[model samples]
Target: MSGFQIGKDIISYVALGDSFTEGLDDPHPDGGNLPQGRYRGWADRFAEHLAGHVGELRYANLAVRGKLLRQIFTEQLPRAVELRPDLVTLCAGGNDILRPGSDPDTLAEAFEAGVDRLRGAGADVVVFTGFDTGFQPVMKHLRGKVATYNMHLRAIADRHGCSVVDLWSMKVLQDRRAWSADRLHLSSEGHRRLALRVCEVLGVPVEGDWSEPWPQVPPLPWREARQEDLQWARQHLVPWIHRRLTGRSSGDGIRPKRPDLEPLG
Candidate 1:
């Protein structure tokens, strides 16, 4: 399946990544038994659009929330290989950055390991989704972290003969209207925007209308605070609360600095 030409034959794609790839905080459209946890991320949108353009193209999503690069290389990559995918999309590394006190070198190594393993497994087209650090306030320090990882990713993709999708350059994160309220995850509209990016990168015709209302954003199933939950409340919500108290946006109030990100390569 890996060597199958995409234009000549219908392709089979497998998506492997973390929460964004898994559609975390997005509602299931069908609302079936497991509907609340259905695939609603960019990968799903990419598959839907790719299906309409190609014949008999099938997709399998294997993205999990909070997945580290080590786990992806050690576990997910092999399983994805077993499926023998013609096209593969990967959107990992957020968890690695979000982890406590993570260094660039460590994250870079883990990321490269996954890419090496996947390329060795015969994936024809390998797409790496870039990081979107603009979504979270706390991610300010981790902006360069993505570039560090992507540099290695691009190098590996070139050496191994694969393609890459630079999500970081899309600037979707800078548009607050495109993001969810918490400023951590992508809204349904955001997912659609992401689907378009994937289609353009892969040279596949987009399937559905990009203007449609997307699947609703779902609630987090697990308990615990994300970096955004903490920083968003601190920067935005706290200032709003102070405004309500003092009835003044003119006066000095709590202000948090946005994280600095490296320029897109």
Candidate 2:
């Protein structure tokens, strides 16, 4: 366990954002029982860790899949404020970064407003920057946009006295294993490691390391790799583009899994 500590006990935590916060692709046994397909993501895992430390933790996850920063700022922020949580984690703007013609500066401004409001309500806030996507075959083009957004997010975190989980520097996440089959959300193991990282950022005591290396595997043959890429584009990328063109979101009509701050299991 790391010696670093936040010192302040967190009794209530409210998470706000999109699919990453919503825990997409990290399926849990009981996930189907929750609202919005509710796969257990890093936020839920983080809450569980805190519960282990404090013996009681009230947690709420207001994130929904495919939400842009503006939607989160408008729909989730007010509810988070009403909860009056002791801790808040915001990880929005990712979907916005993926959209064509989206401006990172404008998104950052909206994000900062939410952070300031949460901090003003006396809650310790945590924010996450996007990961370095240079290694991803389909996502490399968006790397610059992600980097730009990360810079703005870091500045906002500093301005608001908020904790920052700098995913851009997390080398472990560069592994292909960290991503799901769709090449969008993190896999279950990836989500687990991310939870560990968040705990580390908060200075919370943790038993395991997120940086443990994955077992090595032989690289795919050139033909096989090309085939996989084609399949991914067909199964995931095309649908995503369709959604964008149709002005529809994957989160349409979906509700948060854990909308109310209730004791963590």
Candidate 3:
């Protein structure tokens, strides 16, 4: 791992996906305010891990809630292209599968289109992610949907010459402790594991657990905040706080700053 030079070569990374990629269940220090929507997912950990590997690289996450294959192509992918990212990681299709009318054919087409658009925009390496069907309620119900989506995703990525992270079959998914109460989003420890794996996929070196040690500080004003409420804060509040903290606008995890589409752009 030390022999690898990813630290010297890589710079920007843009993550595009659904709720899991957004880090829905992960807790936040600011009363769960950072994720704005599921903002604390692996993408956030990936960025922090990258900071350790590389210095001064831009990390952007454009993952959204309930986003489908088509939405990513029309919306998220375009914005990502504008960043001119060096590496692009996508973890979509979970929400598409959970949709009432979701069908494999429609999803396959959308994934293909999104991949093509990203390649056209000159992303050097695109890392794709698969669903963890066995770990969640909705995914368990649609287990078959995961295979169908991955089949298409793998085929498209192969044709385009890109890499993928098969989270569905990864051992991490088997651990109950890896997920949050929702059984979909990752817990803090889960996020740490995810960061290590994603670094391996990107051919980057990983060190440490990458988990944010729970601060000894007092808890948030509220006793509790669920995933849905956390998601709301992710899209609305986190960016505001990031701007305040750094005097620059950005989301905590993979989500990026696009003032052009502020107010949930």
The candidate maximizing lDDT is 2
After superposition of all CA atoms, the RMSD between model 2 and the true structure is 2.5
Residue-by-residue lDDT tens digits, candidate 2, 101-211? 998888888888888899888788988999899998677999999998899999998887888898999999998899898989999999999999998888778999999
Q: Go through the candidates in order and give the C-alpha RMSD of each one to the true structure.
A: 12.9, 2.5, 9.9
Model 2's lDDT to the true fold? 0.87
Best by TM-score: 2
lDDT of each: 0.63, 0.87, 0.64
Could you give me the TM-score of model 1 versus the true structure? Answer: 0.72
Order of candidates by TM-score, top first? 2, 1, 3
* Worst 10 contiguous positions by lDDT, candidate 1: 256-265
Query: What lDDT is obtained when candidate 1 is compared to the true structure?
Result: 0.63
**Candidate order by decreasing lDDT:** 2, 3, 1
Report residue 97 deviation for candidate 3 (angstroms). Answer: 0.6
TM-score of each: 0.72, 0.94, 0.71
Residue-wise C-alpha lDDT for candidate 1, range 173-257, written one tens digit per residue: 4665567665666777778777887677667766555444535666554444466467678876777557546745321221111
